[model samples]
Target: MNYIASITSQGQLTIPKPIRDKYSLHNRAKAIIKDTGTIIEIRPLPHRDILSLMGILHDNPVVKANRGKPSQQIIDEESAAFEKAITDNVVKEMGLPPRKK
Candidate 1:
């Protein structure tokens, strides 16, 4: 599983095609480069899209659904609170003026 690669004058290295194919790496994939005392290691970033993220957490068994039904008023209040938290986080990240129109 070893191959020779050269570092270019611009400080870029070409990871050989065979190694790339074996590791399922694609163009522009992010990697963590570690410089241990004796060796250099490159690790790929985790898959980040929703489906891949869900797959990582899919092993847990589902529990029985909730049995006690809450009153509609309580449910509406809780839903509104959750939505407000999400909206606030989004706005903070974007740093846009409060929604207009």
Candidate 2:
């Protein structure tokens, strides 16, 4: 979908609803704009949670504790929720039905 994004005097571009919805970009979400010579590319920023980076070897007995404690149960759960939300948005944008619980 094509959208007319407005560039502010400060050189900030406000992505339109359709494009944002298509790419699962929400309010205050970060993005990466690239100049590819032939065409410009706009992509959603890499979404990551510091807690999610912990416990890289949660299942490994030796490395589990040394890499720092895993995210608290609450933080882990919230990260999962964030992942699900992004996935759901992508599915919806692709015209696919949501998965059944």
Candidate 3:
């Protein structure tokens, strides 16, 4: 499936209709871009709501170890931890005040 797409002035390229239709990529579909040294790849991500992702890690060994807790709780905790790390990094980089404990 060789398709050519021209990049616009703003560095955006439109995926041709045939490829979009084949991948079910309708309006506002999200695509993940990756660069693997020699090649770049674009992959369409399935549209799913947060609720749809619940229990996705239910059978995982790590999640199973904390069986009593809900999966959403674990997700929330991890999300908070990630956000904190990002905030801390930005604060350090910008010489901002340390975040209150």
Model 2 stretches with alpha carbons more than 4 Å out: 49-51, 64-101
Which scores better on TM-score, 1 or 3?
3
Model 2 per-residue lDDT tens digits across residues 6-79: 78999988888777787788876778789999998988986664666896767886454435555586578668
TM-score of each: 0.46, 0.48, 0.50
* Per-residue C-alpha lDDT of model 1 across residues 24-73, encoded as one tens digit per residue: 77886767799998999998775565555665534543212222445675
Better of 2 and 3 by TM-score: 3
Best by lDDT: 3
What is the RMSD of candidate 1? 15.1
Q: Compare candidates 2 and 3 on lDDT and give the better one.
A: 3
Q: Which residue segments of model 1 deviate by more than 4 Å?
A: 49-101
- True-structure lDDT of candidate 3: 0.90
Clashes of 1: 0
Q: Per-residue error at 30 for model 1, in Å? A: 1.0
Two-way lDDT contest, 1 vs 2, winner: 2
Weakest lDDT window of 10 consecutive positions for candidate 1: 60-69
Clashes of 3: 0
Q: What order do candidates take by TM-score, descending?
A: 3, 2, 1
